[model samples]
Target: MPSSGETTTLASGHVAVPLEEEDEKRIFRNFPTFTDGASRLNPGRWLLLKGFKDVADRIYNFKLRESDVVIVTFPKSGTTWSQEVVWSMLHDPDLKGAPRSPLMDRPPYLEMEVDQWPTEVKFFVPPLFQAMCPGGDASRGTVVQMLEVEKEPRVIKTHLPLSLLPRDTLDKAKVVYVARNPKDLVTSFYEFSRTIKRLQFQGSLAEFADHFMRDELRYCPYWEHLREAWQKRNHPNLHFIFFEDLKKDSVREYRKLAGFLGSKLSEEQLARVMEHTSFSSMKGRDEALGKSDQMNSEGSFFRSGQTGSWKQKLSHDLESKIDAWTKENVADFGSDFKYFIS
Candidate 1:
């Protein structure tokens, strides 16, 4: 493995460097068994795939445009759902022109790099993505490179915390962050980890929760991620959303999102977007596109999209442990923060 700050020239001719290891001990210090393929990025100590090491500098220095709309979220926090809603608001309000292409192809993930994976692991990548970004092919370019050539007013998606983004991102772009209750988020993420072969997570839900609480999972230290965005909630260009709010009343959230993007949607258009992006609708779409097969997961990508569904899955002891952890971390975040856990 490359050491911290080691630079390498990728096939795309882009010079990339690994994240500087500020505290090696804290990087995957716990749960070394399950975290074999992950690493920590400096400054925030954010957990991410080892591939992020190759593109960290590129993402930090990425240029942003004023018209760009970036969707930021921790993994499995309704990212795909928000992407669909935001993309529709900006590009197809009427929902008539929405493309049949998968959402992953629509808003390019800012830090994704499939080329760095081992040859044995490469087969796990979805075929659609393989075709779009064939491994070791400089002509197609990395995801960040693809973003550079995309048309203006692009809608970009990322799981990166605010600290890793371009310094001028907020000044140059509109950012929408969606937060989910940790209970549901963790439940969804646990299921997702099991589905993705690359993660290599074979533990029980309880063990996964322990890792999550310890900030060992990818894009973890979950509360810290939320706190960064919470501090910047007042910024004019940053729009903060709760995943529960969308589940409770998507129409209202959709309107608020459209307004944030400065798009005026007629009632008909709003209804169309809501209908098209609903969880059931998206799941159906994913099935029609055979995304489940492509993902190599046993179930559909869009699992149950219910709020507070963790109550059904978590044991009493596990729930209490999670609650205590939540209380301790969010003590200083104010009462409004309770909305996320409640």
Candidate 2:
């Protein structure tokens, strides 16, 4: 499926999976080491998780077409919500048929490494594979392997920051970046990392907040990630949306997205998209696609999808620290997008 010969079909009837050890080593060598010069998987910092290296390479080498729509976000920053909205906007509900599986199954998280997921999470991977593969046999191929074969105007998702992203892909395709306030982003990210074993971030909230402040967390130095995108907000091909803004009025944001994607929807069509992408609606429909089996104790992916949930979780001191840090890094950085820190 990989036109560039990046994928391999195995003799055992599998494809692009069980990556060769050599490839893993080669891919890691390309990623920048930690700021503290520690192991790549150092606590709080991002690591090249299992299957990440291969997916990263595939994303870099994969051809980019102008019609492609890429959903970029820092982890847990309303990515799933945006994906559902975009997917709904792109397809005709009656003609194309309602999504048989979850939005993740249809749009596909480009960097989602199913094989690399923790064992408990792997149980849910089979359902995702069934949705993607023809015969419902997950053994057919890897995540990227399936994406490599997808049709044009593909809706892809990624957590990569601008610097690490493939330039051509951003330049040619429609890029939608969704970011949330650092407080909520960190809270959600912390909860998500704690749930997903692969992230290896085991610690108290205070410790996690400290790590975040030091820019030691995955795709962090949150201000910088937001800053980079903010600078490019005016770019013709890019559309930037704030999570709080969407939370306040998803209909307006959805319409903005439709306009950006060049999808002209009738009033009735827009209403349908809004209803389908609602938090309660998503929670009710895609439980399997929301949180994996490993996170059964935690709850759904639509966990309290609100703007100020941080007030309940974050201590006053941590909130102050976040506010001060945001003021220094984001507000004082000459960012016109300072309101995003809300």
Candidate 3:
């Protein structure tokens, strides 16, 4: 077996093996874990994947270039949608070519634990790159190794809070942070929890809502996640976007995204991008860009994509709870952010 922190060269490329059991235990002991039902929250403060804390560490230290564009979001807050839009904007301006491959295979999830994700979530991992090292099967590659194989100007995705990402890379890379109203966010997350194997979420909507308010859900303390990014909103390289804003005027938001990336799109090109990235078209085909395990199990991920679908799903009392929680947690943000004030 390879030593810890050692990389083994594969027929395709180099991939790192898992740490020795004792070393892994020592490393993970520093982080906290939470549990509900059979779900064991392995360490990381945000976006808790079952046993992916080590991968999170790898992502935190992953070498980043100035040209890299990173998409950061709390889970379910338009991650896939934003990813598709950015991917197209950067890679396929005309929308004329066939997808080079599934979006996941293209941009790659920075911290996705391919082995930990549900079995149904399949993508074409070509043999050109060895995703993970020896122990992992060829079809299931490690996120880190896959990312290492990518070329520059790469678009990466992550759910980690700003504090947890690589400090050196934070100021160097163009970071796009997207958020949604907590009500819709919570509702969507509740439905999403049901579809993931690791969440082990066996509870009613109200129960899950309670978990949400308490910050017990994965990638949680929604307010804190926003707070960290909000404080850094003015960073020259960081961009803040809202789901409602995107829903209200996708063209304008897409234009802003294009501008941030220093790319120019004509009226015709922008319209084509808007049409291709629309929730309807995205939902109807390619399984919402084929980036989510939840979508693979749930069959469809494009549920109502409206600005305020939470009005129907959340009970009056639960809505009151969310409102109060939002105000209390994000009081300092004032009314600048639409989600808190709306």
lDDT of 3 by residue, 60-145 (tens): 56778888899999888998889888878887879879446565556777656532343343232444345324454533336656
lDDT of 1 by residue, 1-342 (tens): 444445544333334434345333344343333332455555466666566555666667787889999999988899998998888887888767645356677788776653223434531234455555546344333665556666666899988788878778899999999998898888988887665544435678898888889887768779889999999998999999999888887878888988999989989999988999888888887775434443444644688988988999999999999988987888678777644344
Best of the candidates, TM-score: 1
Q: Residues 4-30, candidate 2: write the lDDT tens digits.
A: 224433222223332234433333232
Alpha-carbon shift of residue 316 in model 2 (angstroms): 1.2
Global local distance difference test of model 3: 0.67
Ranking by lDDT: 1, 3, 2
Which segments of candidate 3 are over 4 A away from where they belong?
Answer: 1-50, 114-141, 197-200, 287-299
lDDT of 1 at 126: 42
Off by over 4 Å in 1: 1-37, 98-100, 114-141, 288-291, 294-297, 339-342
TM-score, candidate number 3: 0.77
State how far residue 106 of model 3 sits from its true place (Å): 3.7
- C-alpha lDDT values of all predictions: 0.73, 0.65, 0.67
